[model samples]
Target: MTAASTGDLLTTPDDLFWQEHSESITESDEELLRIVGSADLPALLAALAAATADTSFLSGDLRPPLTPVDTVGHPHGGMTPLQQERGRKVAFAALKRLRDEGITRARMLSEAETDTILEYLGNGHTEWAGMLRHELDLAPDKNGAPDWRFEDVAAGRDFTALIVGSGVAGLAAAHRFRQAGVPFAIIEATDRLGGTWQKNRYPGVRLDTPTFGYTYSFAQRTDWPQQFAEGHEIREYLETVAERSGVASLIEYGSALISAEWDGDAGAWSVTTETAAGTRQVRQFNAVITATGQLDIPNIPDFPGQASFTGTAVHSQEWDERTDWQGKRVAVIGTGASAYQIVPAICAGVERMVVFQRSAPWMLPAPAYHKPMTEVFSWLSRKVPHYAQWYRLWVTVLGIPGRFHTVRAEKDWPGAPLSVSPRNQQVRDELTRILGEQFSGHPELLKHAVPDYPPGAKRMLRDNGVWAKALTSKNVTLETSPIREITPTGIVTADGTHHEVDVIVYATGFRPSEYLEGIEIKGKEGIEIHDAWDGDARAYNGVTVPGFPNFFMVYGPNVGGVVAGSLHFMLERAGEYALKAIREVLERGIKAVDVRPEALDRFVEWVDTENRQMAWGQPYVRTWYQNSRGRVSQIWPFTNVEYWEATESLDPEDYDFLA
Candidate 1:
């Protein structure tokens, strides 16, 4: 069955087109189409008559009709099913027409008008509105960049910055520089921006985090249809941000950075870019920000006899969208985040899906996994001031903070390996209850789903419940045995059991250890970045390195959030820091500002020590968080606030400044 077009799904074409193709379509045309599509002529006339009569249907306790109500039956209070359906349709059409013409309308205000409507909607909850105002930068002193002065910097010199990659992080950095009145150019390896979002376009690929929280703080999106957005929506959002922020023109599509070297005498880094036209051009820039994220490269595990016998094999990241799996017996490796989402989505379509589970992940209940937002809820969200903002804040504090708290070890606890303390146990117990409730009739299924490791030892998966239900289905099978080799037909286990399969999807995550490994970066004294890192990636605040002067990395090593906080928040912080660093160079007449080796070392030491106290660093669980040497090097070990404070200001003493 073909999926329904996005146009048919939404009630208002104005909102739908804006959500889907805002950059492409005209707003007035979209609104006109929406009004015409929703209502009939009779309903339109009724709405006009109602408006003229000053009749109001708007109410705080408004709810959508249960089935359908007939206006003809209003005199007698009873009507046929067909009459009820037709009258309800006409009434809805009338409402749409009246709304479109702006005649006796009840609509919500935009982000700019949120403050004025706060008193009317807040109902004496001034603190909530105050917080919303502060967050949205409607209030004074809440400007995101307090340190960087655009006028002073723009007047000094025409300095240039070389930004690597055109993903969210890179796009954000470029925007920050543009806002700061700095001349910069972005070199992207691919022909498109959006980084991972642009690359990973698998059938069911979507963000685990909510869209509102995932977006940049400076650009708050008020119209997310779903709580958690899909990959296409995210990519569109990034593209919109780039175009609107004026960063789209600055990006050189199909331009890959081959190498970057610092010149002590010139006091600039020479960057080489290989364009799609097969020509190489070298440009000099005063600063560089490596915004290449961690998960760009795919990590495919080496299984024995894999090369000899294969029907069709592909990684989750490198998903072949065109590949047909209609009646094919498919084998899925790994039960991680990607696998969790992918399995359930494709289970019904495939003939047989055999999932190879290495370890079970901690699954938290998510009721909104499959539920779509009701029209009433959407209307309420738009009408209510500070409601959506407060909901987002609640999610940030309660949902995000508890994730960090679960990782910390406590002295007294019943379950040593499963939980660290009483609070941790409460989390585990809640998860257990959710699992039990989901698999009420089948205790055996619940047993298989329960994780043995402590919560947050690995990435906690949002529960779909469909995964458990799918496993219990007749066509699905879950295998825990180790695979010895892949035969011509299928996989062979260590126990000499052969499970035949037509296709295989390796959901094994990215090689995060090889951060910026492919890029050839040479600093002063002819030191390559790869050699400097020595396979153990470390950075001062996960932005700047000691050897690579004037070179910064956004979403770099140990800078990722451990809690449920958005990755965009980290990217924003890094961008803020980059702006500060660039401003200092232009103002102070400094040629290069390399991080002090001592400071970088101390920061790495602190990251390591802090991670040791978390569950990801525990000896039992094997995750992508560690390097080959078994050191925790991927995730940040502190709260989101700590990172915000650390990168909010730039201290000159942290770096070695040279004339």
Candidate 2:
């Protein structure tokens, strides 16, 4: 079905919109039932209750009726089991009433009624209602503008945007531009579209997050072949999404942006790019969005004598697809996220695989990893309205709030050294227990498996028992010792042991803190952005920099929510912000709009203060979030909602709009 007219959605109140969409909801119920696998009222009620209860990190700003009520129908926490049971029964009854009543609304719900429904579905979270609205596409476009109308109005603009990188972020930006009826072109460095997915072709490369949550919000996919899809599958999905969204044809493959310099006189950015044919081309755009994500440059550490090694050496990002991995003695260094997936995939085929770990990553059990969706389930999810949304929301919510609490440092809390707080320590204990159980037979491996740092300090590796099993394999060895050097045929440890191997795979991660690694971005007044930040990138709302006029970054500094939500969500939010800024420039007939330096500085300071309390900011733990100077260049250390609010509107005072 086509999307409802944007005019109708923008003018109508949210409550009214919901009330009017009953027929739409009714039409979806059959598919929804199919998705849920049963029409049993009790089963559906139970599922809804479970999902609502599963959501934590309540915003605490929900209206009165949406506030949590104890078992006795009083608003508060800490109710007894019987009281909780009563509350569940009450909620289930309400759900059954709504379900049976056919959801037809003659008029909009009152504030109280709206709050009640939010309470039932949103589980007392203030943010849930809005999220649901967004999922339903009932929410207005950026800054309360209607989608189609905005496009019509913006079609007259003479402005153009050049988006670097054709990954999810680039594609998201392109879609926004298309929706706004703006002229744009996407420049993808590689021959293919998928950025990281195209580059990293290592065996068993799969997503760490759930498929639904990882996919774009606007372009939701229900038939994702697998729960946690492989890289290639996701890449293909991205291509399909781009095509469906009408942004595919706009992308220019095998083109890389070398530098972007803002010309004060021309009021535009002069961007230099090199195509695959060894030809350099210069293009000018009114606005330029740097969608080159953090994972572009694979950071291969300079291991001593690494070049002298007489073996096939490759970074995991640059894995040679044609190389026969069979019978090869593989030496995989760096046991991070890439290594976690790589070891499991290559272990069975390789004669011997040595996994070198600098620090053990936090491993959590994920039964769904590597599990494919049943055909029926896939069909239901694709066809069902609100089915994929609910499921994805549930999966996405599970990772936040609870996890967010554990990461923040608690002052003087016990286990402060090992973990930031008691909740974090509990996470450590739980993960430790799992590690113990997994490596119970091998005490030596267990000792090395358990990380010394806090749970969220590094990325928590999703364990489907595959990672543990790979590590404990007969031919696999986990080495935590410091590497003294890489000899001709093997890796030499500090303990004087040489672990010989036929191939060396560097599963090292990317240079995330180093934004736009190779590209030189010269902002207004010949100020090089790379030199301005001085190796520590900072941005206002992670989208705009002070000197950069109409120059934006999609997955920029302080936008990496490593411990929280999906990157795709953050990218969309950032992309919308950038698009909004461009819209402002065009609508106002401005030459360029540079974010006020004072405003940018204040934002950076606030971010620094907030990050200081986060797990990544703790002095005891070290991760890629921080730069060489120990400043947090990556990771937004707050709730995703906060970032959403900050980016929703462009504050005119924060920018200098030139006419």
Candidate 3:
């Protein structure tokens, strides 16, 4: 029918259905115009059916096959499903005839149609924009540039940089040096390119952050198969980033940085590395950047006779994929984030799973935790301009602001050990309510599932009922008793009770406090990094150290965020500062630049003060975030914006420069 005559059809639901279902329909369709003006019955029905189909698809239901329905031979009436399926030949002919005969010319414009069209175009434009960005190797600016400039340096004949750990951070540092035309090479303890991403290949191991936010600010990936990329994908992405950025050539994968000493006479750093070939090589460099992340070493708790466990035991980071757990009674130690994800994943195959919980994680609801993108939504994201961008912005807001509410302390809260304040208690109450709703019939289960600690005291876990379901399952048992020892057959509790298991998975987290333990870093005056802090790692802005002149650290101690912010945000800021400092060293021909003692002290004091105000600093909370001195050593006690602003400009007054 002609667009004008389609007014009657547009008023009916059928017209609405046709307009909504037509993927090729442009923004200028007149029947769409009429439907836009008034509610169309057909479109409503079509929309409902489409939504139903999407739900079914998401739930893994089989889709019905398209079958031809009979139709009357009256212009638009005779358009049977079979005819419409004829590769658009019949539909185009019918439309042409209708327009030619002037049977339909009614045009009704509506705000809804305009919105829908704009959404479509917006998504299309975004896809194009992403493609262009990927091709150009451009990452979207997360924060504005820093307000620092490199000071002029005395001309020097030689300039060099020593990078420790050939991981993402290390490689990124090397890449930055390359771009700045600085000579540098990476030294990694492992004979591999991917650091944590390379080492951790357990099943279902993946990034919790979105792929876009997780990647470097200079590299953008448009074709992430999943919104949250798996470990393999992340590793591969890092590898690609290295290769495409030409930094891979500069990496010496098997060479491990053993120790680095600053030579005051030479005005350079003397670095020691152990090669895979069993040879030790010492090189000198003008600067060093420690890119070793915090989550490398697995922190297996010491239970008496843990070595005596007869069953196969492995840490989550060192998961033994070769060993099968099917029908075996498995014991999982710790209920942290990795444990939370791995427990539910493997509980189905295990005959009986015993989870030993030292502490419970404060669980947050993740509605789309296991849900996949609907085909319609995916299509709209790809085909419509700016549609996906706006949707992403909405998601970012939820994560940035709303998520931070859980981290703040609530004073005078009734629930001791669980919530610090009333507002914190409300969050706990909400989460407990969600758990209650999930386990509607099992009140007893709620007691064991809910955590007593404040929400942000520990890492908040994302839940999808998988954990709750696994817990309530008949094959699962939760243990809260203090473990006395690991017997030949299984675990022995403090009360002389034994729980037998065929396999043990240590979900105990990492040794974040032990920053670069094995690697000996000797700074100026024969000072080692280990001895400098005496196991208490601290730095000015978590980048520059006092005695370790011209040295920088990315993702260093106290730079991590417990709140739901991006780590990349911290990495970029640190990198920016490092780059500016390096430029200053080059420009002024400075032999060394160490953060002033006062600056370092002031920064540490500020970090401690801010951390005390947060839940991580609470005495009752026992997390890897704290060091041996019971200090919050792993987390940054500031907002993402604050870090960005603070690192935006490198103050020359903060450092002592020597020429």
**Which stretches of model 3 miss by more than 4 angstroms?**
1-156, 374-377, 384-402, 410-416
Give lDDT tens digits, candidate 3, residues 546-633: 8888889988888887665457657766776787788777766668788898998999999898787777787778777899989999
Reference-based lDDT, residue 42, model 3: 19
CA shift of 13, model 3, Å? 47
Please give the distance, in angstroms, between residue 616's alpha carbon in candidate 1 and its true position after superposition: 1.5
Whole-model Cα lDDT of every candidate shown, in order: 0.67, 0.71, 0.64
Off by over 4 Å in 2: 1-117, 138-157, 374-384, 397-402
Which residue pairs in candidate 2 have backbone atoms (N, alpha carbon, C) closer than 3 angstroms, thus clashing?
none
| Candidate that would win on TM-score | 2
In candidate 2, clashing pairs total: 0
**355-375 per-residue lDDT for model 1 (tens digits):** 998787777666576655545
lDDT for predicted candidate 2 compared with the true structure = 0.71
What ordering of candidates by TM-score runs from best to worst? Answer: 2, 1, 3
Candidate 2 minimal-lDDT segment of 10 residues: 67-76
